[model samples]
Target: MSWEKSVRRVTPYVPGEQPKDKNIIKLNTNECPYPPAPKVRELISGLRYEDMRLYPDPEASSLIKALSGYYNVPEDQIFVGVGSDDVLSMAYLTFFNSDNPILFPDITYSFYDVWAELYKVPYKKIPLRDDFTIDFTEYYGDKQPNGGIIIANPNAPVGIYEPVSKIEDVVAHNPDSVCIIDEAYIDFGGESALPLIKKYDNVLIVQTFSKSRAMAGMRIGYAFGSKKLIKYMQDAKFSFNSYTMNRPSLELGIAAIEDDVYFKETCNKIIATRERVKKELSALGFTFPDSKANFIFAKHDKLTGEELFLALKNAGIYVRHWNADRIYDYLRITIGTDEEMDKLISFLQKYL
Candidate 1:
């Protein structure tokens, strides 16, 4: 069967590989090395199999209320999805139109580009500065109007964060268009854009349990914005899949959100680990952006990113490698448990 021309043109986003070996020190995906709060496990264990007969709360009300209280936003202003990726896709459908072109940093979460392609929306990629930082002046400060804007706060692959104040300045100025801040990795470091949502009706902040919350397996994510904007996203979600979040995920998400202490403690640990990794890499003559996220983007003059990635893989260590322009030599390595990181460093020391 033939697909629609738009579907045919789309190239789906490639997630990090989940290798079969359990012994491998997996650092390719930016997943939390620690287990989610023990409450999540308890919650999951308590779930009855018979509950599967009924659909999950179509709106995930409990989780929404929990998030509302957590973010200090009203329930009407929050919407949860299978993952932040779902919320992002819904944003593309609900806010972006074919008439107005979408704009985002060229070196950002790859899924943003995929969404643009999937929706057949016109988009222009504003290149990052030579120093690998987002140049908001070139994007929003210019007179040109865009259909919508999406940016990863601490952008992926590069692992550099844009200040929340700078983001506020840009969103404050762009009142006419939808501005989406994908904060999937923000909890690790960097300020959340949730505060700006109260001030800007056009701004939408998407977050996920996959990263900081250690709920990637639960496939839960959410978006915070004005009630009106959130309603539109809800409409989009219902139009596509009313019961987008499953029962187990919904319950686990609630438990995860409620367990703030575990989340904060784990995040702090990851932050410390990230700094240690950064210092070690820098000492080895490797250059990397000062990462605020749980990962580091490091590259050495003596070896290519691909070479290091392959070498690490051969040594039972996994990390992410992208061949994009100006970043081809860098490897994105996730901060894992202290023991896991030590193993990775040992492998690098031996191989490099």
Candidate 2:
């Protein structure tokens, strides 16, 4: 009991439900319905089991080189982690140490607040406009005076993509703090704020192989920042754990990056599916923000979000729904294969 009193405690983030049944259509967690690049399959079978006995490259140099060549950023500016969550947690720990509160959208990624609370970082959640879009002017640190900022472009659940110009404005205004842009879904259809990294020394742009590369299982996430910013993050990470990236992840992540053609094709397919499904959902009396990501956040004109979520679940379909304020009426449905989306539409048609 004495030790328990000193233990750090905070409510953890609740992820989308991962049901056990394999036969059901799964569109809950915003994962790519498609398989990873064909090369990834080839690489997995060829990997030496003996390699696992040795520790992976602590710097993850090979993977970093691959990413550097692909993204055209210098290797020194790059940092890799187990996942974007890991990368973000490290950034929060390394940068948001100020007594003043960090800032993020109230309706943005749920993990931001959890990380803030877990690390004892004071934070302010600025409310998104009624249309579920961020008011960039509100993010002007000159007015709000915060220690740091993190934003999820093509914001999750809502799936609205703010323009790079708007993102740039936030970064420009907040020169005193580290501004992080979480672009996990940027490959889907959104323009990235990555260019701003060159313009602002204080900016860190984070991305993941999980969503677009179909390697969420591999848990590869990386960031690009000024060399100084990245080095500081590396010092913090190495101090915490040098071997955050394992052998399989490093090798497979490079394989995923090298298959440029396959990667683009997969993203295009998801985008096409998303646009078609948008039209279909609209016809079905559902309305949602224009989604640039691989998911649609929808609410039916006649039915509640939970009603549809339960009905679909009972029919062996899974889509995400939240009981929280403002978005309680919405369902965040990951864009699956065309057949899966058709099945979803067919079920909704019959049920309605």
Candidate 3:
């Protein structure tokens, strides 16, 4: 049998390739090159085989408690999911009704559009400004009724961030519908929109352990919102998958949260590396958007994004290339260790 009409219209999201060989410098995905905190490894190592036989806690109480303490939000205001992508998907399902269109930036995480199609929700893509920054004026001027909004902070590929105040202004103006701030990369440098949740019942903030905490393999993400908003997400979660976070991931997520020092240090290192990379890229006649995430979006006047991406791949380094209309010339390169970045710079100097 053929797939449904909605599936026919959908273009699936393409994640960065995870190569089998460990030799490649994987700078395509914005994953931390560093390992997770020692405590997380220790906890995972100590997990009993018996725990695998039983089902994980459906509520993931300990993880929720730890996150509540970490973010200073109440436990009832939190909802845990397999990953921030999962959380985003749930939010799409939970908040966006079939009658109203969902709104997001034209050049965003890309998955946002996919999720909308998967859920059969109508959507409007608001284009970014000429300089690659989001124009809130165009977004809110649409005057759509009963629709929701989602934007990635320090937004993917572009790596530019919206100030917390700007996000607050948007939420204040749109009290009638949900406003989701996907902070998947916020820990790198962007200020969180979590504080806005206290004032706006419509605000929902999504975060993950994958990037900052070096827990991509664990697949743990959580959302913070008003109790009423979180309840709807919880209901959606129950309907889709009652227990998204497994036992080992749950335990290690708690450990990762408890070890705040490790998390901060790792994130600081990535930020430092990012700054250095930006400086070096500028010196090479490459212009990039101001970055607040672990990655940078850069393009050289002499080269196309696809050309640079292919050259890097040939040098055993992988970076992401977007051929989307306005951003076709830019490459999204993730920050790795000092040595790895040095290698990348050296390669670019010769190639460009």
Candidate 4:
């Protein structure tokens, strides 16, 4: 209460719980269940401790070059940040300056509203359809001015992936406003809108190494856009903090990108496991959306989400549950390894 009135006094976003015990099977955060590519470990262990004395690359040149080559985008079009959260926050601060409200789905990433409030940006939530799918047309028609648009493809909590064609429709209609696709979970199953960057100058695609690359602990995230948009976000970033990247992250991130075979194999494994678990949970009388991401959002026929969430927590199996309206009965479960999932399923068998 003693802080300045203008200081950030808004309610903050609460991330999934991180328990102290290592015995817990954490299925709440939607992080990659497997380890990062072996090269990451090899590279990090060999990295000289003496290099920490010097500041890391301000522009994150090596990693950007690797990403540019992998995604076939130009190096100049890439923007690297602490995490996708940082990149999105910078994007919100930089691109959404108009007095008009930004647009996002009502039940998408919980952090969207927190960032909007922290930056004092105006934003409006468009309702998801009855099945929790995005209606691409809801963003069109010019009835109201939108400052910008952002959506999580394979949206968080719901785990429903919108097709690329639908994404194109939204970006095409908002030619003047920045349209950002938060593709944090795209690597699992959804088609990427990265190709649209070549055609639409106003589009931005943000992704993370935290999910697919299993580097959540490393905190690396990046974005790609037209040269103009990238340049503006870069300017905003440098102004905020020039050396946002550190020595270990800049080096290890490049290692993660170089191991393409391992990356795809890990994603494929998670996808396979997700499909199998979906069938098992369904057999247990749970109903969920058709998930294309590395997680499933489900509600049991006889159990409230809160009840099941507590039951799993006591059993040392963690998954996410929200108290928010429309989703209070749902639990968002991250797809972990086969063994971990077996444990989860066995624990849930008692509910039947």
RMSD of each: 1.5, 0.7, 1.6, 1.0
For model 4 the local lDDT of residue 89 reads 93
Q: What are the per-residue Cα lDDT tens digits for candidate 1 across 230-274?
A: 989888888898988999988888888888899999999999998
What does candidate 3's lDDT look like per residue over 126-210, in tens digits?
Answer: 8888888988765562465548888889888799999998888778777777999999899899789899888889999999999
Tens-place lDDT digits, model 4, residues 25-93: 999999898999999989988999998899998999998999999999999999999999999999998
lDDT of 4 at 312: 95
Cα-based lDDT at residue 338, candidate 1:
93
Task: Provide backbone clash counts, one per model.
Answer: 0, 0, 0, 0
Structural similarity to truth (TM-score) of each candidate: 0.97, 0.99, 0.97, 0.98
For residues 32-132, could you state the per-residue lDDT of candidate 2 as single tens digits?
Answer: 99999999999999999988899999999999999999999999999999999999999999999999999999998999999999999999999999999
- Lowest lDDT sum, 10 consecutive residues, model 3, at 137-146
Q: How accurate is candidate 4 locally (lDDT)?
A: 0.93
For model 3, the superposed segments whose C-alpha errors exceed 4 Å read: 1-9, 141-146
Best by the TM-score measure:
2
Q: Which sections of candidate 1 miss by over 4 Å? A: 1-7
Name the best candidate (by lDDT): 2
Itemize residue pairs with steric clashes in candidate 4. Answer: none
